[model samples]
Target: MDLGLRGKVALITGGSKGIGLATAISLSHEGAKLAICARNLEQLEEAAAKITDLTKGEVIFVQADVSSEEDCKRAVEQTFERFGRLDILVNNAGTSAAKPFEQVGTEAWRQDLELKLFGAIHCSSYAIPFMRQAGGGSIVNITTSSAKTPPASSLPTSVSRAAGLALTNAMSKDLAADQIRVNTVCIGLIRSDQIEKSWQRLAPELTWDEFAKDPRHDIPLGRIGNTEEAANVITFLSSEAASYVTGTSINIDGGKGAAL
Candidate 1:
């Protein structure tokens, strides 16, 4: 099961918690150096400590808001400066900003696009040349299953993620000549900090396990997914194990999504 990730360098946005943190740990376990960025320095420091404690691998934290183009560029530059190269770029910075179309104001829509869509664009744009210089690399964009099958009340998040899917496809084609592979993971309901907060707000009476197994979610797996489950796929895609995987999207939704 050698993923060929030893000594490789990866940059993960929004790596302060949840799937991003999980992915950073997973990659580090495989002997990959990591640069993770988030807006919150305290959370980023905590995440870095956790990863270092768990894997004892090289890991750095960058404080940056991916929504800002300059921040995205700085994150990549800092990664390259520290790591000497960039082998993987995981566009994992985003929030599930879902709401009814009528309820989502113009500013909310604009902000969603900036963070989810342009964030990926800006980071990848800066990381590409470095990847090309290194001979080849991988880019894994974190999207949502709703991008393919938009459910009711899923506004800007779905639209923004759909654009991410398109961006992944186009980038794969355009970067293929340079030996860079682009792929995306479409997430389902996964256990994370945000999900825990949601559980507390919506159903504090039920235990966490009870809330996760609620049949109302309709997850075919009979429960919500864990962060490591999603991270495994992302780590694979970011490694040589998925060298031929590109321009495609994988659903990690336990068959909850309607589309193929």
Candidate 2:
């Protein structure tokens, strides 16, 4: 069951909370040194503390916005400087307003694309060098299932994530030649702060526990996914476990994609 990830290094975007935080903890527990980034220094520092408690792995937090080219470049550089190598890059940062297409403003759409899509692009551009230099590595992009199965009215974020899928597909071949594997992990309603806020806003009458059950009841398996579940898949994609898997999008959504 060992993923052979010991001594490896990773950089995760939006590592301050949710899936990103869980992935950081998971990989660290798997014995990987880590560097994670988020715009919120406080949250990033807190996440670093929790991961340090769990894995006792070398952890550093960089305060940066993934959408900015400068921040992405510095993040990769900081990882190399802190860990001396980069073995994995998890493009997990994203944001959206969950508004209808016509109702969504131009600025909101631009911001969503900038953070979710361009952020991945910027990170990949910088991280590729270290992966190339190290002779090989892995990149696991955290896109949403909405990209594949856009729920009734979530066009802006869906389109952005679709672009991410294309990017992940396109990078696989060229990167694989350098021993860098690239894959996309599509998410459903994994437990996170966003989901919590959504619950309060969308179903305020329901208790937290009751709200948690809503999505589970809706999905075939009758439950939403947890961060650990998603993180496990990410580590698999990053490690020797997924040696032959590349350019493939793995849905960690418990079969709620609606594509079948």
Candidate 3:
């Protein structure tokens, strides 16, 4: 029953909502001190409050745009300042700028990479040394199934996120010597505010519930996914339970990926 996370420290990016928020609470429940960051102050505050209420573990929030180096640095710096050590890093902050191939341009692609790929890069850059010094740690990147499936609508985001999987795998081998484990969760369609927004942007006519119905039938699980399911799996990997696992990408999509 013990995850051995009691009193340990974790830093989660994009922790204001959805999977990130859920992971924060789950980690807290296992007794990890948490530092979560997002660009929106209000959303971050609300999410932080909810996590604190749910887990009662030490939770702190800071405002940071993951796309910016200064902000990324500041987030990790603030986390270290507050926790005095970093045992886990969850890079869950990402955005997809979708468009038809011809319609997409350099800037859009750049932004997508900045948010999804480079954000992971920057956070990992700062998280590693402390983790090494503190006697190793875990890093979980919440990537998308888009990397595998490439949903027609989500363009550059898919490309960058796919790259993130590569990042996770590659880092796993490199960081293994330091005793730092790196793994990734390849996400499927999850019911969340971001999904709602994506739907509105791609197909404004249908309400979110209506939009969700079509996919539920196609996915073998007979339903989509939620924050809790994703968080639970990540919590397992984040714990000592997955001590031998690293550089592996687990597709938590209820058999949707279908790829070996």
Give the top-scoring candidate (lDDT).
Answer: 1
Model 3 residue 247 CA deviation (Å) reads 0.5
The prediction achieving the highest TM-score against the true structure is: 1
Task: For residues 1-260, write the lDDT of model 1, one tens digit per residue.
Answer: 99999999999999989999999999999999999999999999999999999999999999999999999999999999998999999999999888899999999999999999999999999999999999999999999999998999999999999999999999999999999999999999999888899999999999989999999989999999999999999999999989999999999999999887
Which order, best to worst by TM-score?
1, 2, 3
lDDT of candidate model 2 versus the reference: 0.89
Candidate 1 regions with alpha-carbon error over 4 angstroms: none
Per-candidate TM-score against the hidden true structure = 0.98, 0.95, 0.92
- Residue 76 in model 1: lDDT: 99
lDDT of each: 0.96, 0.89, 0.88
Compose the digit string of candidate 3's lDDT tens values, residues 1-260. Answer: 88888888999999998899999999999999999999999999999889878877789999999999889899999999998999999999976466777788989888888998999999999889899989999999988877877867778877998899899999999999999999999988787887777678877897766776666448887666788999998998898988999999888877788564
Q: What is the lDDT for 62 in model 1? A: 93
- TM-score of model 1 (CA atoms): 0.98
> Worst lDDT window (10 residues) for model 1?
251-260
